[model samples]
Each structure stands twice: as structure tokens, then as C-alpha cells.
Target: MIRWGTSAWLGSLAVGAILAATVTFAGVEDRADAGRALPAPTLSTPPTSSPRPTTTTTTAPPDPCGAVAAGMSSRARLAQLVMVGVDPRGADDAVDQVRAEQIGGIFIGGDAVGLLSGGALGSVHATASLPLTVAVDDEGGRVQRVDQLDGELPSAREMVARYSPDEVRALAHKRGAALRARGVTMDLAPVVDTSDQPGRTVIGDRSFSPDPRVATAYALAFSDGLRAAGVAPVLKHFPGHGNTTGDSHLGSVRSPALDALRGTDLVPYRSLPEFGDVTVMVGHIDVPGLTDGRPASVSPAAYALLRGEFAFAGPVMTDDLGAMRAVTDLYDLPDAVLHALAAGADVALWSSGGRTGEVLTRLENAVASGELPQARVDEALRRVLHAKQVC
Candidate 1:
């Protein structure tokens, strides 16, 4: 990337420096002749000129993801930190978008069966040189993506009530296998939030049980089932969206104080031995003392709570930044994305796609202004790439 003009300018500067040094020495000699006797300049032969032992600088080759990343522009690197939504029916559009932005992943929303049917996703992967995360809300019951194709699954609550944890895991395994068959790599499922909300309420039947221990067991079983099926499961709405004041899709939502969450809502996230190879989605709920009354999605303290207290080393994602009222009502799309990624989220998810160019431009500016450090971006990028097992 070095320009020819820059090299020429450097050469001229080097030559000028040599001339200036010679003239300065000449002036010194003249001054000595006119004013006082000058000692002969030390002429000791330059000590053995040890010829620098023919050193060789060997650069280690880039790792798998690093090799691809090395050739990418800064903007492209930033783009890969975002996961945008694409229509399930628009396989061609999805392919074109991925080719254009080289984004980290894609979320397929709605009930459209076109892209998820008949090997339609193959077209998108055919041209993608990098590993692509194809995610969907396949939690089953109230929220199911491939139920129409693979047969509907019971609600989380219903599954817990009717079947043992092991049986539930088996059901999830089957569902996970079906989703993987449709080319989906990630499932936004097994709500870990412990809530007593009505079955039809926001988190509702999506939750396994109100007891934190029960919720944790069922959630872990579901996650294991997905992992067994080769699809990464995302444990979502962290900090407990189950009992929040309201739905984030409508507007602001507040969670219980952090202290209260430690016993109930946050119980399922005890860091266990590990969350395994999975991603945790931070929700947009406003936590009283931890998040400064702002949504956790854009709060540094909130992400810190997860990374610090929970000991979660896997990738983190933001809940629907594009369509959620909790974010949209507060900030514009581009700013929300910048804030999310800056706050420590590995991938900023905006399930209502588009505005990628605008958001990425703002992120580029954020990096330049030091609002979003390059080190943070690189860390997040590596986490995302690792989640895809690309490197």
C-alpha cells in the first residue's frame, strides 16, 4: 500500500540529512580554525564492522481466520462483527448481501418457508468463501422456524411438564438436527429466564420453569441437544427478560435490581463448568443499578457483569437492535449498533436488515475517534469467527 511518491519523498529527506551533516561539520572546522585549536576528529577504524550476522526475519503465517482477515479492509473487518437480518424467501438477496458486506452472519425471521426449504440455503453458501452463521428463532412451541417443515414442537413449559429432562433433550436433538438439515447453524432458543409469566406472555411458555434450578437444567439439556446435533444454541435475553416490566419490542423494559437477579433471574447463568461452545444474547432490559437506566444491550457495565461475574468467555450477541423499540426509541440504527459492539457484544444483531453500509460507516468513524477501539473489534471478531469454528 505504500505509494511511490512517499518513497521518493523519504529518499530526498535522507539525502538532505546527509548534506546537512556534512555542512555542519565543515562549519565546526571553520569555527575551530578561527577561534581555537581543534583536536583531530577520532579516526579509529569503525570497530570491526561486525556485518550483522545475516539475520533473517521469519514472519509466522496467519491463522485460518487471520489469513482471510489480513486481506480485508478495516470496514470489512467491522462489517464481519455485525449479524444482519435477511428475508427467508430472498435466497439470492441474501447471497448478494453476504458477498457485498462479508458480514459475520444472517438471521432468518418470519414464517417464510422458501429459503429454508428444498436446499435453498445452498445457493448462499456456494459463493461464500468464509463460514457463515445461519441463525433462526427455533426454540419450538410459540417460537419455531422449521416447525412447518419438521413438525411442530411443544412449548418449553409444556415439554417440561410432559417429559423428563432427558426426553426434552431428545426432542430438542431431533429439532436441532432438522434445523441443521435446513442449513441453520444457530438456534436462538431454550429461554433460560426463570419467570412465572402467563403461558402466552412475552417469555411465557418459552421458559421451562419458574424455578432457577429447573430452568437451568432444562436449558442446559436443550443446549446439549443442539450441540449434539451440530447446531450452536444461543441462550438468550440475559440478565433475565422473563420477568421484566414489559416487552422490549414495544418500548422500555426494566428488570429487577442486580441483587434480586442474583437469586432468581440470573441463577441459570452461574457459569457452571462452562456455557460450552455457544453464544449468549444480551437483552435490551434496563437494570436498575447496573445499567444506568439504559438498555443492557448498550451498557458496558451490563456486558461486564456477564463477562466478569458469569465467567463467560464465548461470544456475546445483542437482541434485535434494528426492530426493538427499546433501542429504536432511544437511538438511531447506526448509533445503536456502534454502542452495542462498543459495549462488548461480539456480534450486534439487527434482525430487520439493511442500513449495513450506513452502520458500518459509523463504526469506521467510531474506530477512528477511539470510541470503539480496534483491539475490542479484533477480540469480538475472533470470538465470532471461533463460534463458527472457522479458525
Candidate 2:
């Protein structure tokens, strides 16, 4: 606090002048405190000192993900949402494809040792403007892709039978690290479907267990290990494929009612994602009460169940549309791709790599004609960015 005595300012004209100057100085200070600009001097008195320079408030930089998406041509951006399979031997050709199309990702299906062995994937990573999502179906058992290089891993059921959940996690970490070392970014693995069929049945051996809680625990552990290795783990066959009677590869397959799935197959999804982030693969099987004949991979209702009911916010991809008989019976590769995107899939994957140009052309035409909204394409592109961690 400051103090002033009456004797210091009373009974004198000079004292009154000093008091008025002090009042002016304090008023200027108050105006500065209030964020108001100071009044300019009438005579423009600046010869005695240099004036203070003005400053600017800083702003946040624009969104890098949005900037990358906006910088591409319409067809080029659409190309990024489609993941095509590449011949494992034709690594150079695949690199050329990504350079030409601004392709989003590639799947390394059917072991050829060329792409996964001799550091060929380094060139593929460099070819794209964005980082490519190099993926594989390294689900272990007969479904494993790189067994020749990394040695064989047990089936999901076998892992559970022989090892504890933590041990399975350690084994999966070793597997994921091997995949990452080979430049594989995504693993379509650890099937969470609930099944009780014989070990030789289609999804039977691939399933972790018939018990939903057990399946969820093992899936979480496996995914944790994959995440620890910087590879994204994918949960497969949304709405469940374990109890289904047939395979979608041969013909259209159907699952039990939604009510029944809620008690069994759907249990893993509701719990697994709560533990960690994983991309969900919607299967080709049609649901009796939900899909109306369309496979879940192409059904809006099924996606709604995944996106809304189950509340899964991670990336959602469609199972292979190129070879699946369920979809081939109705539409060609291009149409199947379109329906999956329009139905809310983030990525449209086709293990059959040809026809990329044909499908892309159709997609461009769809955007021009409004059959597929540009907003929908943008939304999916954002999800693709999320999956690749580009955003």
C-alpha cells in the first residue's frame, strides 16, 4: 500500500499541478489494464523515444489430416479408402500401383517371401504420398501368412489350451514384432467369434473359445501384445460368425438372430474394445433378422448395430468382397465396393487385386452422379487415416 500526507499536497499551486499529473498517469495505467488502446498525443510527440511495436496473437496450425485429405484430387482421395491385394512376388509392380493411384494400403496374402523377406516393403512405404497400411491375415494355424519366415504359430484354440492368457500375450508380442519387422502394419487376427464346433470346422479352430468372457480375455491379451509391438490388431466377423452353419467363401451364409447373438457372439465386441482400440472387420455373412439378404459387410443396418448399438468408434472394414461368394452372387467387385462404402465401411478390402482401375472409375462416376455422397467418402477417408495413424 502507498500513503500520502495532506501536508505533501496542500496549500500550494505547484503541489496541485503535481497531483493532476499523477492522476493522468494512473488513468493511463487503468486504461492499459482494461485492454484499451492509449490515447494518442495531439502534437504527435515521438522524437524523444522510439514507439513500441505491436504484437500478434498466435493461432493453432490447421489440421494435418484434413490438410492431407483436402490436398488430393477427388479420385485420388477415393483411391486411398480402398485396400487392394498385391501379388507377393510382384513387389515392384505393387509399388508402381501405389505411386500411380495414391493407393491407401496393400494386403500381403499367400506367402511368396519376396515382399516379406528381402526388405522389399521399404520401397512400398516410400512409394505412397501417405504411409501405406501393409496388412496380412496372420491369424495363426492354417490361416497364417508368414509361417515360413517366422515359424508356425498355434491356432487360437490351441494357444488357449496350451498357454495361459499372459503366455499367449507374450507369444503374440513375439509374433507381432516379427510382423512389424517385416513391415506388416495390420494383423487381421485373434478371431473373437464364439464357437463350439470341432477343431476342424471353419471358424471352430480359429475361435478362442465358446465362452464369450473367455474369448474376450484372450482377444484383449493378444491385441495388447500387438499394440505393444506397434501393429494394429483387428477383431473379425462382427455380430459373430462362430455359430453359423456354412462359410461365405462358398455361398451365402447366415447367422442366428440378433437376440441370440447378444447372449453369445456379440459379447466379445461389447467388452474387448473397452480394453483397447482395434479395427473391426464386418463379415460377409447375412443376418437372418437384420441383413434382409444383403451380407453384413454391405448392410447399413448391420453397420448401425456396430457403430451405434455396440458403440465401437474404431475403424470398421469389410471382409474380402472380391472372392466371397455371398457378394459375387449379387454384384461385381466395383458394385460390392460401392455398397460397402455407402453402408459405412471405412475400408473396402478385396484380396483379388486386379480391377482397381475399374472400381476406382466406377467410384468417381458414383461421386459425380451423387449415388455415393462425397461426405461419405470423406468420412471413410478420415477413418482410413485414423487406422493408419496418419491423423
Candidate 3:
């Protein structure tokens, strides 16, 4: 049961004051040099279990591709790179595509919990020829998807208010388990952006803390706990989203000076190499030096920084194409998909508007015309398939 009381209240706490007072931990050291001497987790000892299972039931059959390494596949592979939105109630049009297209994954909204639990997902799983990575943004507090049915969980900032990084991890663990029981396989979560700028009021409480070290620690904990619960975790707004003032959902946004971003905003992504398997989500921020005036989702230079500088080999996904300010009403829907893939983004996440097929068809044309290199597509597909296989 969620403890509801004075401890959980967030309104009384002034966010700006808390942020202004937050002490920056020493500049982050290489994972090796952080002097904190906590013992590493071992297989011999496990954390306490959550509430018991109501009944022991037969387990689902293992995936044949479970242990198979990721590789290029004409059909299965192409589907992985296309992450599309399905109707929260699981519309027939969505199910048809899931089966025929053999899509790699699906993103759901809050209303989708009914579809997931009430046989919509079960039927799709039964009908689909290949495994699918079903994901949702249940980041607690503001970005919760299952709250309407299961009750609201605390926000990321709220959790940080009441607990230490360790406790936040435990909360994420329980949250992951609940989603898993409802058949969700992936969590688009742990907003790793260091929310400090006054202009970033939108992502204010969505971020863990203004302190990079605190942000990194809390993010790593959530990722660790989700994986422990058999749910894949994605660290988002890569390169960074913290320094930007405008909401990407509305208009084009840019971060503060590249120097300031390097020092504070990117701490979480920089820390991921030591954190084990983690997926990074690219935001739509336009950093002057890194993106060269284009949004990060549509910039090759931004992708190179994440792949080359950060050395993040796991999948890299773009934020919602529909929400992107660069994608406007005047442009054809398919161009959004083409531009993002061409720019080096791997997974094209939730098509906010209803034009997923239009985008997919354009991608197919790009493949046929040899505009988008087959190698890049193959690499992106491989990453997507590997994620689905793991899920």
C-alpha cells in the first residue's frame, strides 16, 4: 500500500529553493575514482522480495531467439527500428500491422493498461509471428501510464524528496514488477537530465536531481532494479535535456553553452558505460556545436557524439516524431521518419499523430532508392531485434 501522509507532500517544498540549495557533488570521477566505498551487489545475497505471487502458474515458453545474437534480418530486423504507437484500447488497425509488419515494438499510453490486461495484448502476442517489445513511460509522478487503474506512483522528484538513491531503486524495482505482471516488457524511464536551468520548468520534477552525481546514482539504480525485474530500462534525453528552457513537445529548444552542458548536463549518459546494458533515448534539443543548428534527432554529429565519444553501443532511440517542433504541419509525414533515420537515430519512437504507415512506407522507398544506406539500417535493426529478443 502506498503510504499517503505529510511525508509524501510535494506542494509545501519550494522546488526553486531546493534546486538553488542543492550542493553539486565533486566533479564526477571516472567510475573507478568515486571514493564512496559501498560493497558491490553479489549473486550470493539478494534484496528482499516484493509481495508474494497470488498463485504459482505455468510460465510462458522461452523465446527461441532468446540466446541468439543480434544480426541483420530483412524482415524481423526492419521491424525493430520502427517503434509505433498502438491505440490505448488496441485498435484492429494496430493489431493488423503488428502481425503483418512483424513490428519490433509498441509504445502505450495510460489508457492502454486495459488493453494490456484485458486480452488485447494477449491476442496480439498470440497472433504475431515474432517477439515484440511492448513499452510504456511509467516514470511515476507526472509521466505515469498505469495510474488511472493502479493509482498514481510518486514522481521522480517526489521519490527523491522522501528517499535516498537506494530507496528510489527499490521503488523502481517494485514499479517494474507491477508493469511486468501486466505484460509490459520495457520501461521508457529514468529521465537522466540534470534539471537546473530556470527555463526547464516542464522537466523540473521529471528529473531526479539538479546534482549530476545524484542524477547518475539515481538513474543507475532505476536501470539496475528494472533489469532485475525482467524489464528493460531506457535512460532518456541523451546528450542532455536539462539545460533547455522550452518544451520539445511545443517548439524547438536549445541547451545552454556547450561548455556548461559538457560539465553538468551529460553526466548521466557519460556514467552509463560503467552501469551495464542501458538504452539511451535521444532528445530533440539543438545544441549549437554538437547539432550544427539542427535538432539532435536530425543531426549526424549528435549521433556520432553518442556513438563515438560516449561509446554507447546499445540501441539509440529518438523522442516522439510527432512532438518534435521541426516536424510541422506543412511537411509530409513520411519525411519526419526519413530525416530522423538519415540523421542516425536507430529507433523512431511513438508516432504521436496517425501516420506511422506513411513513415514506414517512406522508409521503404528510401531503402529502394538507396538513399538511406543499407548498413545503417541493418545496424539499427539489429539493435532493435536484440532489444526485443531480450524483452
Candidate 4:
């Protein structure tokens, strides 16, 4: 690990971020039997010839996952890791990108339910080539996306503080079921961040508990519940996003020290099982030894830490690419895609923007330039397909 204050650290951080964000799934499997674990579904490996394209429909629609599995070429597959935004007011270009770019997925803002339900989600599902994983931050409290119409629930801290783990489990199960009914497949939830900082209201009540053990228990329960409801639960802000004074959505954030991260912060995430079939969401926070002061979404050491040390084999996604200030201020759409893939990320996400198609084009160019490895692209596609089958 490079010292936080050293100049040598900058080079490693840049390279790591680029690679980690480029590499990075679909799924609906039943886990309704309470604690019983279900084996995840397998994604299709690359084929010599692409499969025949499926037709779209209103009643049956296309098997969104199947279309994505077949339509993406090797280079396009590499580009799919990027999840860019679309105009919340409504736009046709996003649908066009879904079809032309064969995008990996999309991120919808908290207020996008009307748009998503009206036509946006349906358009992406029916037209996109790959199994597009539609996601939102519906973690309840202030992060609830669907609550504008569905009504917000209690904060995680409040829920855990007032109720039992089983109560949180029930709430998560209900939330997941609701999302699934509306055609949303992934919920970026169960925060799992352990905030120990004083008056740090940003992550406050949203996190399950300040104690890693309690937070871990609640997170596992929430994940199990969501999975049972056929909605994938994403454990977020990996290695932990709780101790930061800065909010990544607004600007860059760094931990006070490595010790602050190792103790209470990462306890819940590190304590979880292999989390083999889970989807882990990376945050934009900058940590010294882990992210080397770059965002975790595009950090090599961050990737190595999550995949190599934590042994979390599930799909990895970034917090919305459209929302993070670090990414928005530094590069254009395609450059973000390249940097993310190179950093070992499986998904580059955005939740608000009109340039989603342009972003996709940039990713395509990078693949053509051989800046990213084709093998990594293939692995990401495989994982996506597998997730859809098993999760």
C-alpha cells in the first residue's frame, strides 16, 4: 500500500481506478424458505455465434435478459458495465441507447417512478439487448425512491432501534416485493454502513447500527428477505461509507484514517458470508490505503480488497455515475467508462443525465482501442446473465 501523503500513490491510484471500474449481472431466484440458501443461477458463457434475437411484445415482452445475452458483441459487452442516466422529464434517446449501445442497465432517481412505470422501464426492458438491471436507492427513510408515491418507511436505525431484526427483515421483504411488482429488479439498499461519527447526519439513521455486529445481522436479514421476494438487494458503500464528513453525491469524501475504516466502518460488510450471489454497490468515497484518495468506484486496491480479501464474488456496481461529483467533474462519459472498467468495477452507473447514449459510444471506442481487455468484458457479461438466472 502506498502512503496516503506520498506522490508515488497518485500513479497507482489513477491506474487502479481506471481498471477497477471497467469490469463488473441479472437474476430472480426464489429464497422464500426463510433461512434456506438458494444456489444462484448461471449466466451463459460466450458463444461462437450469437443467438437468434427475440421479438418484443406488450403482454409477454422480450426476455430482456435473453436479448442482452445475445445482442451484445464483445466490444459492446465491455461498454455495458457503464450505467448512465436519462432525462427524468422523459427522453427518447435513452431508449435509443438501450437498443443501440446494448447498455448494461440504468439508474432511476427517487422521483422517477412515474416516468419508469409510464414507459421508461418498459422501453428499456423491451428494447435493450442485455438483461438490463434496473436499480434505485429504495433503502427507506430519505433514500426511498418509490416512496414519493408509495410512502416512505422508517429509517434503518429507527427500525433497528425500535424493532427486532425480524422486523427489519419483514420491511425489506415488503419493499422488495413492491419493487418487483412494478418491474424493478434491483434495489440498492440495506446500507450496512456503520456511522460512528458525531452529528454525521448524512449516513445517520440510514445505517442499520453503529455496532458492526448488529449492522451485519440486520443487513443479512434484509438481504435474505429481499432475495426471497425476487428483488436483488445490493450491500452498498463497500469497505464502508459511514465515517465520512463529505457526501460523494455532492463532492469527494475521505476517511480520517485507515483505522477508522477497519474497525466500526467495515465490520458489517466484512462480517457477512462469502455473499456469493449478492450484488455489492461501491460508493464514491476516497479512502487512503483502500482507494488511495480516489473514489472507491474506480480504485484498484478497493477492488482487490473487496474481491481478493473480502472474497465477495457477487456483481459489483457503483453508486450512480450521474450523481457522483468526483466522476462528473473529472471526465466525460466514455472516459468514465474506461476508468471504471480498468479499476475492476463491474458496473458504471448514472441516474440523471441526457448524454447516456454518448457515454455508451465512448465505451465502445475504448474497446476498439484495446484499452480494456476483452476477457474482462466477457466475464462481466457472464456474471450478469448468471445473476439473472440464479438470483
Candidate 5:
């Protein structure tokens, strides 16, 4: 639903231009420092998800990058941190961009996935050297992207009402198998938000339950199913989006104070680490206690809470940066991307395409001018590359 020529669009372009000019002028003195060699990346392979019961576990292989990341150019390494959306019908263009940009991942909307067959997905995969993180929002029910290809599945609410957590796990396994067959590596699903309000429009039926304990059980079950099927599950809208009444796709939303969130909203995230290496998607909600007023995705304090308070060490990604009005309305696209990285996001998900190259250029400029540290970019790239290898 994001369109060009809106007021927000104009504002973004204006801000981006100003930042570009400023960075270019400041970059002259720091360019040499930016080009200095990075230290060898040390990454531990996270445990892969198991298809068995929650109690079963398996160790993943060694780091996939090895020496490949060290040999990559700054631009190539930066490319690994951006995940962009592409049109399924325009497979040729998407493939061309994959080669041209060396981007880390490609994602398709629910409606677009219906139009793309398995062969089409494979063709896209064939274009990449590294395995592209082919992701889809196949959460089932009202949010599934490939229901046409995978068959219609019940919503989380319906499944929770009619089935046990074990049953939901089995259903997720089936869904994950279908996605893997079509070349999908990641499933952006199994929303763990615990919202009890019947009038919660943004996440009403999407959440498993208002009870945090119940939601956690179903989420872990779903995660087990995905891992069993060889697909990585991305636990989404982190710091919880259930309490908010506003939709981030349209505008900004606010959440409770950190203390209040800890008791209710953060329960699922705190307990999820027992499942192992699950990617957390930071939402665009403003939690006054944690961030003062900035949206969680772009707030350094918010991510600090995730790392320090919650002790989560897995990959952290931003919710759709280009599509969400909470971001698009507040800052230029490039600024949003920089802020997300500065705030400790490992990946910046841009569900709307056509701006990949521009964002990459801006990132290069930021690093050159020392507005963003090169080490920060390297850290984000390391986590992203590691996730692509193991997850």
C-alpha cells in the first residue's frame, strides 16, 4: 500500500539529499580510516532448530563464511545486511538485482507468492552464489503469503481454539515443508505477542493468546515445526505489538513502559531463548520507559534493553522499514536504515523495493564520513551472514 509522490515521500527525498551532501563533504578526511582492514570476524554457529519435540536438540555446522567474508569488499559486505522485496512477476529484474546488488535476501508479499510457482522461485535461487534468504510471511490464516500454493491454513486464533500446541506444531511443519520446497529459507511468522484486548485491531486474531504462557507454548511449537522442516522461523513484532491499537504500516504506535512490558509483553521473548537462535523482529512501537519516544526499531536504548535486559544474542532485524509509516513519516529512508543499524539491528528489512542501491550508497557515505562506524557495519554483516549460513 506504500505509494510514491506522497508528502512523506517528498520529505524523505529532501532529508536524504541533505545527508548525502553533508556526508560527502565530511568524508574526505575519514575515507582512509574507513578503508582500514577489519579484524577477522569471530562467529559461533548457533544451534539449528530441530523437527522433533521441543526437548530434542541438534548442533549446527561451523561458520559458513570462513574466509569468504574477509575477502569481500565493503560494498559486498554491506549488501549482506539489506533484505529487499521484489516483484514475483518480474523475476528477471529480481535476479538481475540479486547479481548487481549482491543483496542478502529477497522477500515476496502474500499476494505475489500466489502468482509465483515453485519453478519460478528456483530460477531466482539459481542466480545467487550464496544461498539467498528467500523469505515469506507464511504465518497461516489471514496473514499467509502463499496460501494459494500451500492451501489455506487456519489463523493463529482459530488454530489455538481448535487445536493443542502439539497439533499447531505439526501444521507448521507441513507449512514449512511446502515453503522449503519452493526455495524459501526463512518464515517470518508465529507472532508471539500476548494481547488480551478484544478490540486490538492490529494484532487481534494474529496473536495466539492474551496469556503469555500459552502464547509461548504455541510459538515454541511452531518454531520446532519450522526447524524440523529446514526453515528458520523469525519471531516477529518484538517487545510485543499486542498492546498497541495502531497499525505501524499506517502510522506510529505506542507501547507500555518497560516495567509494565516486562510483566506482560516481554514474557514470550524472555522465554524464547530456550528454543535457540530464533531471529527477533523489532517493532515500530514507542515505549516511553525504554526509548523516551523513538520507535523501538530505531532506538539504541530499546535494543540495549533487548541485549542487556533480555540477554538476547541472536540476529535482530527491523520490521519493514520502507512500508511502515511510523518510519517513512518520521525520517528519510536512508536515515531510518542508518538509525536501525546504529540501534543494533542486524538486518534492515525493506519490504518495498527500488531503493536498494540508493540505501547502499548512503551507507557507504555514512561509514566514509564516520557518521556510522565501520565496525558496526561489519558486526551487522557478520550476524546476517552467519544467519544465512546456519538458519
Candidate 6:
């Protein structure tokens, strides 16, 4: 476990802030728990498809973890790793939780407009020491949440059908700007799954194409737009959830063999480096060939693949752990949060259930008892602070 003296923390914070500001001022422009059963292998090994060329100007800010570490208590820092959903009716309660528990972020869903309007979100923001990462699922089509407040945008599939890559980027810029105007700083979008199968339901309209190259093109374009608009974009369902017929929200889902995944499921992620510090959301689907029946969200092997093979260095987040039956049916919310963090996810997203105070308490106890390592917590906290700094 890692420990730091108060003086060391303070010094590091000062240095971190200076480095962060220097990097920014320089204007450097860069351009589910367990699987019930193993699924049958479907596709044969296909030819490799290279990602389409795209440019991005953003780079990660200098590490700000020390600044957060020096300023907050352990409980407060741990809270930064959890993202909870809020109800419009209980907006006041949510604000209280933010101040009392030092909750890291808030997600608006279902009637988001009602919950966030009239300075409701601003009221919550007023309670935090650091800027909270206010996020929404604004992927367009059926997955949009806040668009109900403004107007509708086309789905990923529809955008592909009607617009060029440049057009899609323009639309995403407008959407991202609109979300930012409402105090939202992050967008969970640009579904990168490459599912072209005729009957695929979970990701049918959300994905850009069945072709990996096309998906790569649109993913980068959408991310660029979001970054330009000042809202961070998150690439969803990592390791690919488009090929599966099962919905993780309902039950367990499985992927094909490891070799087959390279050509299809892994393409969009391979192209992630081009997008700078964009976040990646790991799904609940199990890949038996890779993880040996453990859900990707809770399996160290899956995260190792992402960090070791793909070289993803940004914040790694989990899909809604409380809402999905794959996890809820197996482990309690707190236990699931521990598993996800231990497996390398930096953010444990609770879109439906789980109280922020209770989650923070459990995480604290786990760390105290060595069930979770302090180093792990520190690393996750660093990534979380890094994300906030960039936003």
C-alpha cells in the first residue's frame, strides 16, 4: 500500500498545478460478474482492416492527482471514483450528498431536463471542491437523454446513412456544445461497436457500421467534435458489445474467440490513441476465451488486455454496475464496485441504485483491511483527477 506525508502531498500539489498550467499555456496541438455459459464461435478470422486516418488536437493535462490528494480526506478522494445518478424529485438530496460525501460526479437520466433546469445542476456544483464531471448519455437516436430538453438528433446509423464523416463531426459539435451549455461536461457516446449482423438488437442503431474502418472514422470524428465543444466524449462498450445478441442490462452476454475479436471487436479500441485522452467504458459482457468465464468488468485479464495490449492510458470506466442484471444478480452493489476497481476500472458508475455514502464507506473499509490496496485507490484517484483537469 502507498502512503504520503502531508507536506509531500502539499508540495506535489503545487508542482502539479504549475506543470498543468504550463502544459495548457504552451498550446501544444497534437493531432458482469460471471458468464453462465460459453457462446459458440461464430465468425472466422477475417482480414485486418486499418483504422481510417483522423486528426485530434487535445492532449492530457499534467497529472492533478496530487492536488486532489493534498486537499481532501481519503473518503472524499474515494468518492471521486464513483458516479451516481440523480432523480429530479430528489435534487436537493443529491446536492446534500455531494457536499456531505464529496461525491465525484452526477449523471442525469430520465427527464434530465426537469432535474437539471432552473440551476439545479449548478446548485450541486456549488458543493464540490473540484468540478464534478456532469455526464449524460447523448449518443443521439434512442439513447439520448438531455436532447428531450432541446431537440432530437439522428442516431449513429442514421447519421452514417445521411452524412459524411465531416457532417457527423459537425452535428456532434453542435450537440456537445448544447450539452455544455446546460452544465454537462462529459458525453457517454460514439458507440464504436462493429456489428453488421442483421438481427443484432443491442447495438444495431447505435453503431456506425459493421465495417471496422467506418466505425473508426466516425468514432474519431465524434470524439473530435466533443473535445472541440469542451465536453469530454467516452467511447462505449469496450471490447465490443455489438456482435452479441444478449443485452447485459437483462442478462449475461458472451463474445467470440480471442482471435476472431482482433479483426472486429478490437478495431475501434486500437484506434483510440489518436483521440488523446478520451474515456473508455468497459461493458458487462463476458469473453470466455479471454477471461475464463469472468465478466470483463470484473476480470483483471480483460483490463490487462486493454492496458497491456492496447496501451490505453486514460481513465477506464465501467458500465452502469447497479442497473445491469449481470452484476446485480450476482454481487451486491458495493461488492461489484470493489471488483471493478480491483480489475483496473477507475470509475464505478451507478446509474440506478447504490447510495454514495454507503459506497464510500464500503470502499474505505476495504482499503483499511487490505481487501483493496491503497496504491490501487491512489492510481484510480489520479486518473479521475486527470480527467477532471482536462475537462
Q: Can you write out model 6's per-residue Cα lDDT over 148-182, one digit (the tens) per residue?
A: 57689888888888999998899889888787777
TM-score of each: 0.83, 0.84, 0.77, 0.76, 0.81, 0.82
Which pairs clash in model 6? none
Best by TM-score: 2
lDDT of 2: 0.82
Candidate 3: 10-residue stretch with minimal lDDT: 1-10
lDDT of each: 0.81, 0.82, 0.70, 0.67, 0.77, 0.78
Task: Give stretches of model 2 more than 4 Å off.
Answer: 1-62
Candidate 5, after superposition: displacement of residue 59 in Å? Answer: 26
lDDT of 3: 0.70
Model 4: lowest-lDDT 10 consecutive positions? 1-10
Residue 294 of model 3: what lDDT?
73
Q: What is the C-alpha RMSD of each candidate to the true structure, in Å?
A: 12.0, 16.6, 19.9, 18.7, 18.4, 19.5
Question: Tens-digit lDDT track for model 5 on 1-391?
Answer: 1110112213322211111111111212334447676555457743232234333233444443534566678788788888888886647767887988878888787375532574776667666655677777877777887777769878777788999989988999998888777777788888998886663378888888889898889889998888778788889787879887588889989887778888777898888666675788999999877777788999998788888878887788899999899999998888899889988998888888778888999988988999889888877876775555421
Ranking by TM-score: 2, 1, 6, 5, 3, 4
- Residue-level lDDT for 264 in candidate 6: 90
Model 3, span 198-254: residue lDDT tens: 423768888888899888888888887877776788888877888786878778888
User: Please, what are the lDDT tens digits per residue for candidate 4 over residues 1-391?
Assistant: 1010112212222211111222112233434655875455456654223434444333433444445446556557665666666544453655766776666666666464555555456666766544566676788777787786566778787778778878877888888777776657777888888875543476877888888888888888888777777777788887678888677767888865666777877776675573335788888778876677788777878877888867777678777666578677776656766687777777777676556557656666766778776666666665665565411
* Lowest lDDT 10-residue stretch of candidate 6: 1-10
Model 5 RMSD, rounded to 1 decimal: 18.4
Model with the higher lDDT, candidate 1 or 4: 1
Once fitted onto the true fold, the runs of candidate 3 whose alpha carbons sit more than 4 angstroms away are 1-76, 91-93, 110-112, 197-200, 329-331
